[model samples]
Target: MTNILIADDDIHVLNLIDIHLTEQGYKVFKAYNGIEALEILNKELCSLAVVDVMMPFMDGYTLTKEIRNLFNIPVILLTAKNQIEDKERGFHAGTDDYLVKPFEPKELSFRIKALLRRYDNNPDEYIVRIGNTIINKKSYEVKVGKRTILLPLKEFELLYFLMSKPMQVFSRDHLIDQIWGLDYEGDERTVDVHIKRLRERFSKLTDHFQIKTVRGVGYSLEVNRE
Candidate 1:
């Protein structure tokens, strides 16, 4: 059975999400704040996490960062702040998805399912090589020559998807649909952000591969053959 940790300061919101997620056949763990959430995470293994932005001790942004640094689980942030900046912040903190407050329970459920599906790393589809860079899907590890580099979840997924089809132009919408799922309601700029992060992370590695923008279209991974 898949377990999920839901952390929120509001008792009502925590219970609401707990009931809905439990009814969906998930083993749910509830926490009243980020500290408790982290404590629970330390003791139990969960497949995913639903975290609230505002909390005592540690905020969702901080908790998500810690989770990303220490665990290989998908995180979805729930918050009342619906601004694009706030959403971007959540993504930058390594959250796989974001849901605003008062959001439909069904939408949250769909988002959770989508994230879990996308992040289900299979050992069979493990290694991908593009020039000197190697992507280990199963381990979520990236290697450039002898050095290893770590990327946030979203950035790593975006890189893997693009490298899977080198030189193929993928429109932002297509990338978002394939990577973030068709149910994602966020702006297309989210794709841009992830792409930018990928570029920055790999810039120092090698010049053999580059992510090129398509101006009016989208972007593509272009590999320079020797």
Candidate 2:
């Protein structure tokens, strides 16, 4: 379940991408604009993203540039503008790859797989190990030591986001936005609830607890130095 985000203003484009990517066995998240894309990007750590150049409020260039600064995630631009200057501009904006409009879905999928293999931390699988816990980001599975722990869908999602960037502080507001999304009518308390659950479960198994409370700041994963 490799996560992939597709940001396009056209409804048809979004539908097409969602259908094709999902059929190809990739977890595809779709957004109609850059703002929506940014919101989703904050929540899930995707292996790659396919973004349209022309979008309202932020556009592909600005969104991709911001994403690059935040995470070393790969971005592929889909643009009607196929000019050399446009491609150069996209590269300047930190785009890893680009595809002009009116392309095959299979080609896009192949390009995405190639980029992930070349750039992602785990090309074969999207898993991150912390302490003795194994996180399969694709399937949203969590295994502590040799035993597997079943987390509720939302809780599993929350834990994955927190673990993606170990030791990086995330404010309650930020966590809420990321886990719940901008449209979710949930408050900051939701973050606390999930954090409490995650800690309790992890504390029972591994001596090395990863989630850390930064007091007023919020929560972060504790990096084991030894």
Candidate 3:
């Protein structure tokens, strides 16, 4: 069954969409805030998400960005903000579609169907982003806003592994095993060199994320969300 998530602080709007999607045979997961929506997503394999722009804890744009980095599901921004800049921001945040409030349920259904069909045939991207920085696992390319960058294979792999689990600490040994493989003869200092290069490359370029050393532990990617 197709699963859809509807996150809105307004109860009436939330229930209304739930009823419409349920009637259309979609298993609906409803959330009143961005945090709840993400919690549900972590537990359920939702096909798509309908997110409102304003909410407690996290806003729709940040939520969409998170979904883009962590999950492959499509996102539709649902909000009352209909300005041109607002739509542009939504797209830049990685939303697949945008439906303003005061929308027809049928229109939403149609959009949902279109996105699901599109994603089903879409190729694997394995893309992860923090703020303005994006790293593509498939291409080994790092992009910050409009500029595209190619990192050394090891550095790219290291940054990708760290960012893939934001804020999660990994010791050098675990990182070596994960990034360099268990058979690698290189010592853990090699990890430090690659990490140093990655840091130098992005230090002045972007502030979207940071690789922080965990004192006695190792390093972790800390995403600075807006």
Better of 1 and 3 by lDDT: 3
lDDT of 2 by residue, 1-226 (tens): 8999999999998998899989989998999998888778656767788989999987999888766654557899999977999999999999999999899988998999898888755542466656567678677779887898778988888887776776678999888788778888867888888888888888768764478889889998764523
lDDT of 1: 0.85
lDDT of 2 at 28: 89
How far does residue 151 in candidate 3 sit from its true spot (Å)? 2.1
Q: What TM-score does structure 1 among the candidates reach? A: 0.57
Q: How accurate locally, in lDDT, is each candidate?
A: 0.85, 0.81, 0.86
What RMSD, rounded to one decimal, does every model reach?
17.0, 11.8, 5.5
lDDT of 3 at 23: 95
For model 1, residues 127-167, the per-residue Cα lDDT tens digits are 66665778888788888989998888888888888776666
Clashing residue pairs in candidate 3 (N, C-alpha, C atoms within 3 angstroms)? none
Worst 10 residues of 1 by lDDT: 121-130
Candidate 3's residue-wise lDDT over 1-226, tens digit each? Answer: 8999998999999999999999999999999898898778756668899999999999999889888865677899998978999999999999999998899999999999999988777654377656678788988888898999988787888988876677678899999999889999989898788888888989899887888888888988776644
Q: Sorted on lDDT, highest at the top, how do the candidates line up?
A: 3, 1, 2
User: What residue runs in model 1 are displaced by over 4 Å at the alpha carbon?
Assistant: 121-226
Candidates 1 and 2 compared by lDDT, better number: 1
Candidate 2: what lDDT? 0.81
